[model samples]
Target chain A: MSVFITAFRAFGSQVNIWLDTATPAADGAPVLRQVPGWLADIEAALSRFRPDSELSRLNRRPREWADASETMLSSLDAALRAARITGGRVTPLVLRALVAAGYDRSFEEVARAGEAGDHATPVPASRWEAIQLDRAAGRVWLPDAIDLGGTAKGWAAQQIAQRLAAHGPALVDLGGDIVAQGKPWTVHVFDPFQPETPFAVVALHDRAIATSGTDYRRWGADRHHIIDPHTGAPARTDVVSATVIHPDAVLAEALAKAVVLQGSIAGLDWLAQHERAAGLVFDRIGRVLATENFQAYLTQTQTHTQKGA
Target chain B: MKMTSTKRFAVRTALVTSTTLATVIGAQALASIDEAARAQPIPAPTIAPADPVLQPTTATGQPVSAAVPNVVILRHAGEVSAPAINVEPQAPARPSASVVSGSAAPILPPNPVQIAPPAPVVQQVAAQPAPVTRSSR
Candidate 1:
């Protein structure tokens, strides 16, 4: 298979783009080159760590009408929708809570500093209804501090995949928040602790898959980025990692984060109840449990060799 | 299973209240409002709750359904056909992979890491497109 693969760092993680086509890499270079710009725009608009970012400006502003770009508006719309769908389990109004949890800076700086968290009590997220958007006016009224975090990343990936799909089959992976368009793409899920070893592999046909866990960026030994909106503390989930597959990348990412925070029982139940999505949840003890419908996407399940086989 | 509109609103309101308290207190010494709400036995619902005994616990030592009740009573859309993606493995290849074509046979490179006893194998299976039976609204 002739494919054009490109990788770059963006949004605090590696962004991998794969275009499956018989054409030369140059044929797809123009379309591929445009992806980074899209991601950079999203980062500048939604990143909480950037004091000059649109999200930061909104967070600092009074509860008055503020001007917003198309990117910020759409991202906020998706974030609020996710908050509603998850019953506020995944919220955009967690910026203060996130900073209170010691994630005030970029994840890179946090990891490099290795500073022990001050163990601040978590403030529950603000109400989703607090955000008012006027699309026609290109303005928004944010009644509380908000953070778009992974929602923007997933939305950006979806946009890139949709755009590139017009040219050819494309896969946009923004740090494991993925969208596969135009063709089926096989992806592997590994143990979060052992990222190199594969636990299961699934094929996505015009679908999206997102994995959220405490493995990626950690400040103190136990302090990771996935914060519970209810507790304001880092989520204490039995499942070390939760990967959700859905037709929408934005929805998949939101559900993945909600699943990790919900733990395995509610997580799996939520997935099972959601007819359009499936998921795999890995617990802290190496036990793997998947939703009933999740097997449909499992083209292969890589397992440790049987003893003496 | 579906929850009564009244019950759903109550749970959502409780959650919103808990959240408001957290934000108001600046996340410093915020009280456990969910715990307080859960401590008082909630009213009996028209529908039987999913057996709590069967629920799993988190590392925090709380039941998965802790505090919030009627979590299983979600609003689902009508059944949708699952996407026709082939999940069956076709090529013998290394486990550590980034991307593979859906239609073409993947080229297998040399397997580098070899452990004792049984080799780590990619167990293949036949593809099955199951209709999705549930969804979150």
Candidate 2:
């Protein structure tokens, strides 16, 4: 099998697409090149910071039925499902809250700004039920400013992997929100600060693993992305970072966010109830706490290393 | 009483033969059981010889004794001519459901009642960005 790997910038992060194809490299080059355009299209449809993006346009018009693209509709659907599943812990209507938290610009710009104090009040997000989607008409009515930022990356990863499945087996890793199809892929999860040493490595067999952390995209010293919809403030839970392995990347992303937002104990309990999902939570002190059956995903090499250690 | 003396004697002989055969069969069965028991390695059981009365099962339906020593073996007729000893069918063993000690099934703790969080207090206000003036995309 030949491996065609491509990496570029999109979604304000490094996007990597690895295609294991039977076709020759010459033949596979064109097929591999098409993914960047596809990712760009998805980004245009879903990005919250882009003023001309479809999501931004929809956010501008409240209480009006606006025609949405197929991509936007699907992303909206995934975001709504995420909100419902997390019981409002994760929601689509968190854009205003996110902006109020000093995340009004791209994460790069936010990080560069490094402003310490919160300029806006921390108000709770609008309930997810306020946003309505007319699937048959391909129109969405947003009564509130709904942001697809949380589920957008994982949903895009899922969509990209699905699109590439026909050509060959693919692994789409969008800023650690991954989707693997056709065969199992070994994913090593590392800290955002320490990207060199992986704390946990899991093998994905037609599965996905998403990591949500408070270590990245910070404006203030303590503040980071992944805001809690409940209080509209940065999650003050014990979990510093959480990685969830699930069948669907979108759900995995949601699960990861929920894990960090709810804290380690409640998060582990919640993950335990989901038979298909397993999680690893890093505490503020850098201790690792994993859910049941999470050890099953540890690579044999890592297992041997732990034994020797 | 109505038949001849010959008939009566035949009936007595038949009764004696049946009794003798049943006794022989019972002896053979007991011998076989003893031989089988000797062939197996048996653990020495500590018997404290309680009241010679049988105790009923507990409220939770657990057996008190590990071994049943007073088993009544019933012999069936019509097998007198057969050389092999007839063994009676034993009752199926009942699984114990012990509440006091080691129970087969695990005991789960009572589920805690979940109290839902208070509803979010939504602040009603006019649109902040003041609806973008341009037409919808």
Candidate 3:
């Protein structure tokens, strides 16, 4: 099979689209061309960094029902569903907490300003249940501000991959939340400390993979983007990163973050409670811990590496 | 069991009077409980409004009330069957002992490229930036 690959920056991380087909020029090019535009539209609607975006407008509006676009409504629905399934371990209502944690600006701006080692007090808790959605009217009511964050990327990846699958086998990677359909594609779980080597490689088909880590997007000591709702602060856990594989990219993203917050052992156990979900966690000490069935998806070489290790 | 008519009438009157008095007392007690309950303040609801003004539409464009309930519960198809097992914590491998191919090279080229697979190339993982050399912290 011939593979056509494209990469660009979107959603604060690199996005890569891979289409496998018999004819790259004939089949892949058309489908691939539309992806960037689609991503731009999604980013425009869901980006919290953009003051004029739909999300920002919703956040700024008073706590009352206001008109929203279909994209905004659906993204909010996905975020709520994630919160429901994870029991608020993963929530979109972390905007205030995120800002309080010194992520008031875009990661790019934060990094460029050398804002590391600065910390802020934890913010008060926000509830996802307070956000109300009227799907028919295309209206939404926010109890407070929210940040779609990685959830938007995962949802967008799934949507784009589903659209591209009509033509041929496809994989959409929006900054690490990946969705693949039609055929099996090999995915490598990168070691957080050592990005050069993969701790595990697995084959996925009609599935999604997501990794959440504190190693990136760090602006302060012990401060990261993944916030625990209970504490309303950057999560403090022994696990440095958590990678989850599931049928939905959105859920995978949520579960991965939830796992990191819960730490390795409890995180893996919590991940096991979800049907068709598997996780691999990297602790602060560089030791790898994976769910039992995680090995089922491992490629032969990765299994060999496991045995040798 | 048999009694004179006057005696039977007297007994019946006494039973009727007691039953009426008991009923009156029971009714008064129930009324007082109802008043007490009404006087108590109702707690504020923790959830959204029971009847959300925004409703989901059907495919036929008809408004379907109660279609979107106040609380949405996500339902998965299958039961969670797998129990979490603790895998032995694998130590970092030696530099020369890395088994995966294309370890040093990046996954995507600067420009779009088409290639046939057999060689393992690193694809970007979710929520992480592209693997690049970074300055020491």
Candidate 4:
């Protein structure tokens, strides 16, 4: 069987699509024509870019008992778990702040929300308690515009992976919120400052990797979208970038945020609790602080890019 | 009654066929390792690249290391993907390194050797070797 691989950069990053199919399809075929029609299904289910997406509907719904799909509901649950685990360091509640900070519109709109005076503080991070879900009725109510952008990406990646389960060997990188299934694939981690070079090239076969850093997409030299729920402002710490790996992408995404906000020791402690979660953190210093399990990931995907990425 | 030569030939063919099937089945087990090796994301770099070195440990809790030099992500070997771009490795010591607290920090008297501020040398923390494959097993 011939291998199928497709990659495209969207949502401000890159995504790699791979598969060892029974036979390869034409490259020009519309994304819809692909064997795994599941991609479209997922794009429809969670795309924040598409105007009619489920998330968009929820975002626009003006108070008529709106229904959330199983995907969103499941994600909410995961976000809640991560929030509890990290003691609220990570949360979906940063939505109000995100919008006020200028991400209220499309990602581009937010990008235009010029990095300004210290971000506007909102009522202490939207409390998850304010949101209500009627499990039996499949309904959700957000007292405030409690945003889920934090956990949605991770949720979407997981959903996409589940949709492609029957497919053979695959990797999905939704703007760096990556999730892989089955056989492993090579991934290169780069130094954000030196986009031209790669720091390490790792072989990841089955786990989800989500990186949280303040490089290009930041509000200012000191601000980025990765908001700190506790302070209602940009998160500050010595760790410049944090990559979290876990069987659960939702936790990984949320945890990455939590760790970057909490700093090193506490972040490692949270990372240690999950048997499947380990991480690598890079500081202002040119050193590598790896969790007990991070070294193994580097060994399997042993290729390193010549330049610092 | 004497058995004919053709009858003996039929028995031999049956034995041969049975043996061939066994060989194929046994070979399947041996191929699993190759399958695993091929299925894995093997290191592609012929020469190890520069490691993400850490700056010396500091008072505030910050990471001291820059990049993990050896980590092998594997099946069932924990999480493998990263959250964002790895930070550029700076030639400074990791503020949170063990050398600062793990009895590795060279002990100094209350007022000890203070060489006129060693001209801005990039102090980096060394990386330990632990490849990803070791943990998967």
Candidate 5:
């Protein structure tokens, strides 16, 4: 197994990179650099931290049509499509809620800010649908400032995996959002109370898995970083964690948020009926739950699995 | 005395036929599944929803979902059979209630007390598999 792990902080969160392949490369420095460059683009397109970034700029110039890159436009397009698919289950309004809840900075910064974190409060769930994108013209027009946090980082990791397609079998994990070109890779789902305890171990054979958990990203015990569009606050659910797996990283990433929003009981049932994505949900009781397909996917011998159309 | 002879003959004939059929089917279809389950095999990480087009699955009555073990769900066929897995199709569904340990409150529309499916959680094995040592010729 050719394995590599790299770490850095981008998208305002510490990132861990792991890759596995059929043949090991002599050195992996060049392979690793691609990740940072990828992060930089995602930040430019999605980061709310930089006032000049796409999201920030859109928040400020909510009316003007700004020229957008194909990536930015496409990402926004996908998010809209996902929103439609999930029935407004997830919305970009979460960005406003995140900032208002003292998450103006990266997660690490929020964790460090303590009481001072509550300084610059804003309105909740700033409604992402109001912020529209023009795919044909590669431009974006916003009606108000909304947080794209619900989808951006996870989407970025997926985009990176797509660009790095030439690198053979690899796995890129942006925080908990992951996309693997292949497996021999072991990913442990974190335990909220004692994160040291891994709730599950996934063996991926060229697939993507993204997890959304309030564990490390919590404000208090009840408050988490994952905002629910419905309530415009952190998602409140019985699910300790939800991990989504599919060949499409974007789909897996988006579904992770939906699962988290749905909570364990409802989310688990939802997964049971919806087989397009394989899922795992952990309850506070420390029980494991997965959809039928997700269970079956785990049974196939490692190496290859078919996904999407 | 007449009843005793008939009972004896019936028992002998039934045993011979059932054993012959048992050998022909080799433990009986679907029988080994429950038997192999005694050890509680390591739970699979991903779950597949019942796809009418791709996998064969029984109608799932529950709203929230959990992964079912090894039972292949075929959507189009509306049938489930043993298969290698990975290549199978899945029905898209939502996660369960109260999944994580010390997690946020339940997110379901109605906080119902229901059993979450098993495919999501990866359980520890009761016994570890044996190691293989290589031999050089």
Candidate 6:
């Protein structure tokens, strides 16, 4: 089947939508056109970088129930689930920590500035249970500020893919968080160090995949976006990157970051506990490790090539 | 006041007979009262059905068929439905067996070649770009 692909920018990353159909004009064009608007709506509600965003307004007032939009409520709900599934390893209440680590502005600004300004001491994330959500009332109460970060992106990807799937088979990629539905799509797992070489290529069908790493978005030594909740600082670990595949994009994103924080050995062990979830971790020494079932998703040609090489 | 033994025995028997008769009559009266109470219908609370009160009607005055309150709509696997009121939002369904289970046969591509940077180099027939970690660049 011919694929109709569209690319745009949102959530501070390039967004790509792929529909498996030959007739773009008849089948996929209209749906593709709506993606940017949908993503913009989500970003307006969830982006922490925007001072006028709903998230910023909620963050300004803590310890009280504030009115929220459906986007805000649903995204926060998804974030809380991610925290629960990861045992608080992945949390939305890391805004203070992120700000302290000099990520107060957008990554573009931080990158262009070349140095993070002096900031306050990092405050450790509060318990995820402390944030209260009343979906029926369309309200949320935060114990402290939160940065949805990759969680929101993953959620947006999943939402878009679900919408597009009604027209045809679809794949939505918000940066690295991806969701594929309706058919098997081959996805490559790239080497964090090399970036150009793919260590493995696997087929994903009706599933989602995400990669989390410290190799990018660094402004200073030991400064990265993936914060360790325990230390309230950038994660100090031997694993440079981790990629996880699961049925849900939100969970995949959370699990990928959790793997990076826990490091390779313990992370792989943790990933095994989750049924039908597989992961690959690349350590600082260039060693590659994958969960036992990860190989099952590998394309046969890639498997053979690996064996021959 | 000494009496003959036969006289005393007759008096005692008479007293015992009266007392037995009175006890039997009292128990029978109590049983009848209890049966009467059981025969009465219990009064139920006077609550009216909520549909007529809360449900809105169409322009034609026909009552709209609203979703039954407290009734959850169950959907088939992978089917998306409107969120039911009062139901906790559930995580997306687990992937189907075709996704999680190992592929039975290898899907061989026609030929593979390297693309360029930003996108993964390897291209197999119709394969899409592999998602990389998010970077500012």
Candidate 6 CAPRI level: incorrect
Per-residue alpha-carbon lDDT of candidate 1 for residues A14-69, written as tens digits (9 for 90 to 100): 56787766455435666666777777887888888788988889889949999999
My TM-score estimates for the predictions, one after another, are 0.68, 0.67, 0.68, 0.61, 0.63, 0.69
Candidates' chain B TM-scores in the order shown: 0.19, 0.31, 0.37, 0.24, 0.19, 0.32
Q: How does model 5 fare in lDDT?
A: 0.56
In lDDT terms, how accurate is model 3?
0.68
Which segments of model 1 are wrong by more than 4 Å? A116-119, A304-309, B1-137
- Across A99-160, the per-residue lDDT of candidate 3 in tens digits comes to 88888877766666667334568876678898899999889989888999847778998889
Docking class of 1: incorrect
Task: Enumerate the candidates' DockQ scores in order.
Answer: 0.02, 0.01, 0.01, 0.01, 0.03, 0.04
What tens-digit string does per-residue lDDT give for candidate 2 at B1-137?
Answer: 59899999999999999999999999999999999999998689876543223322222333233222321101111111111112211221122212111111221111221223232222222221110000000
Alpha-carbon runs more than 4 Å astray in model 3 = A116-119, A301-309, B1-137
**Cα lDDT of model 6 by residue, A1-309, tens digit:** 557677766776667677877453455666677788888888888999899999999999999999999989889999999999999999998989998999988776665566775667777789889999999999999999999995887898988887887788888888878898999887666544434345456688999999888766666667888999987998888766788899999999999999988987788788888997888776665455666566567563221111112
lDDT of each: 0.66, 0.65, 0.68, 0.54, 0.56, 0.70
Fnat of model 4, as a fraction = 0.00
Q: Is candidate 1 or candidate 2 better by TM-score?
A: 1
Q: lDDT (0-100) at residue A199 of candidate 1?
A: 51
The CA lDDT at A216 in model 3 is: 66
lDDT per residue (tens digit) for residues B1-137 in model 3:
77999999999999999999999999999999999999999998664432232232222333322212211111111111111122233333222222222122211111121222232233323232222111101
